[model samples]
Target: MTCTTAVLLPGTGSDEVFVRAAFAGPLREAGIALTAPAPPPDGTALIEGYLAAFEATAAGVDGKLLVGGVSLGAHLAVEWALRHPERCSGLLLALPAWNGVPDGAPASVAARISADMVERDGLADALRIATDGVAPWLAAELNRAWPRHAAGLAAGLRAAGAHPAPTLDALAQLRVPVGIAACTDDPVHPVAVANAWAAALPRAHVRETTLAALGEDRAALGRAAIEAWQQASASQGSD
Candidate 1:
């Protein structure tokens, strides 16, 4: 199947703006149109919003859609693909936080902690703590995104923190080609998780980049994911 459109979702507490910046250029160069929807206002509806957006977008498309996203968004994309494999052409997952139950994964823990901070200290203080030790680019990104969430931010974080990604066993059942991108230096979203996902999926490839590179160029992560997807798709054709 030739997929010309990709519908991507944002990570926990993120919005479509960042998603566009991260993926639009690379996907455009690859001849794929990008659809990045604004997250729902209610944080608790994050997953539902993403799934609904995918369904709505896929409805107007001619063929199967390419689907994926970053962090929690990637998890939701996989979940949607598993449920509707016939409508999905492939995956372009970036920075998958964990497989199966979060089990105190760094990303999960961080989300939970941030949620608590937002509730206890309010958004301003929470944002300060959240961005305190992050890279400048990351901090800037968060500073811009976190404010948008505002009152709903804690709910969104808590929802994401509690949600479970597809397990490795479940992943093995997904036959669609998958391209996973991982940041070598991202402790929150460890590279090992991406490697494990690639190992489990029948038609999958993993590409590595660094957070430093990502900071220097927003498109770095998207380029890695697109390249990995191309490799996976080619391998599928050969098979």
Candidate 2:
């Protein structure tokens, strides 16, 4: 049986391949249609760009539309949901970053590095730093696609640092339910941010799981995320 359509947005410097691994199989198995945009190169315009992409996608699909993302993707999802709560059915947020730029946020450093990359080495240097110690396959892929990846991260970092503090007062008005999944081992997307989102969104249900629980395997993350999505969606149906 087909379920509602859901859009999955990748994090900073991430491509469709990475996000597809994380969500496509699971979402497809769950009978959810998936839509994802290529990451924009300009860090500053990232969220607005994503919002526009989502708007275009939402226009094409019928019925309830669930929006989700990882890291910067999650941030953009939340921002969009805030603006058009009625248009969204629910949210599947994974690895959300800071509520806003906190002191010593890595985004600050990333932004600086991003500015430098556009001029000389391009994304080569930043891509090395962004994916250096990540999963080997992921790192290798980023190494090959460094320029495009770098530009997206540069734009995301600019967006992250400049994004205003998210207020729940607007989110509090949302009738759409939310599911937030956090990776305990993630340094970039902290658990605190997930907890904050849970507290802020009146209908948000949060699950804090370890990377090990989700496994290094992408399928594992997708499975765990689906479980959370089920619980959140079920609750919404009940309400």
Candidate 3:
């Protein structure tokens, strides 16, 4: 039997540990083989690095491929899937950060990072503060793996900074089935943005869950996302 495969990409300042904690266990229970690739600690070239890693891992595969990510990763997944709709069997996007204000309109981690860079001794401290507040499960992983994770953060920051917010016009054209799982009150990924993406994608299905339901708890979120994918895949097969 050919194994169904998926690539789970994490958000900015997040690494494999974080993504694994959020996806691995639950997806395994659901019988999906997902690989969470590690991100460089510095996050400087995260998007390109992640895309390259994904391509490398998927080499020689000829079965259905699912690609998904959280926040900035989600945006990248959507962008890549749009470019290769024939390759992507489905998409799972959670908490897209693409709809937020630009680099200087507050809520802009990009602006904060840039401003902090101006200080000789403040950037490191700021980066610590910015990345430390992740979920405890993730914090434990980050503590165990700092340097490697830091490189990913640097690359992710660069990716997020350079990525432009996706428009409905662009998303509406994608034919690949999509599943959007959103947090109700996440400022970084507002409910409105998720709703918009769901509405825009031609074959998009949406599910709304809370942070409390997902925090440090991968089972709830992963199961929900997987079930959505199963349903979408089933529906697509039926039609």
Candidate 4:
């Protein structure tokens, strides 16, 4: 089935602008309208709130829609699609951060620690630590975006840290087209997780790229993955 519309969700601490930067143009080129909503104001109940918003948004769409997102967003999208299997035409899940649970996942670990630190020490000290200790670009990005939404960021992190991914059985039931993308060298969104997802999902195709390339062109990651999935579908159809 062709995807007419795709509702893309941003990961923890990410805003609507980041989601648009990640997908809008490429999805539009594929004739899909991208609907990316802003994160809810309440951070404490973020995952539940965001998923509810995603479901509401998907329900409002005229046709069967593609649902997916980055990190926490991607994990919940799988759950979303399965819950309303009839509404999902496809999935554009980027950056599968962890497997079944949040335990031992780097992203989760970071989220929990960050959330605890932010809660206890305040956003200023937390920001200072992150901006000083983390990578140059990330520190810059966080500095620019995190101050205003410190509470929201901490809440999203705490929520994500506790969330779990869809079980293997749930993934196996997803027969629609799936485009999974991840960065090979990035520790947060690992290639192994993408490989596991590609193996579990019946119709998933994966594309491996680098963090540098993604930093340079965010749209390229989605473009490559969707194109690969489309090519695989075409090949299978001809066969």
Provide TM-scores for the models. Answer: 0.97, 0.83, 0.80, 0.91
Better of 1 and 4 by TM-score: 1
Ten-residue stretch with the least lDDT total in model 4? 230-239
Q: Residues 132-220, candidate 3: write the lDDT tens digits.
A: 66666545544455445543444455456666656778888877667778777566667787788878877777777877676646555
Q: Where does model 4 exceed 4 Å of error? A: 133-135, 236-239
Give the number of the best model, judged by lDDT: 1
Best by TM-score: 1
Q: In candidate 2, which residue ranges exceed 4 Å CA deviation?
A: 1-3, 41-44, 101-103, 107-121, 129-134, 149-156, 212-215, 236-239
Q: Which ranges of candidate 1 are over 4 A from the true structure?
A: none
- Positional deviation of residue 176's Cα in model 1 after best superposition, in angstroms: 1.3
Choose 1 or 4, whichever is better by lDDT: 1
Clashing pairs in 4: none
| RMSD over all Cα atoms, model 1 | 1.2
lDDT of each model, Cα atoms only?
0.91, 0.69, 0.65, 0.79
Report the lDDT tens digits of candidate 1 across residue range 1-239: 38889999999988898889889999999899999988888888877877899999989998899999999989999999999999999999999999999998999999999999999998888889888988999999989999898677899999999999999999998888898999999999999999999999999999999999988998899899989999998977721
Whole-structure CA lDDT of model 3 = 0.65
Q: How close to the true structure is residue 36 of candidate 2, measured as C-alpha lDDT? A: 75
Task: Write down the RMSD of candidate 2 (Cα, Å).
Answer: 3.0
lDDT of 4 by residue, 97-200 (tens): 88787778888888888888788889889889867856665666677656656558788788888889887777999888788888887898888888888889
Worst 10 residues of 2 by lDDT: 102-111
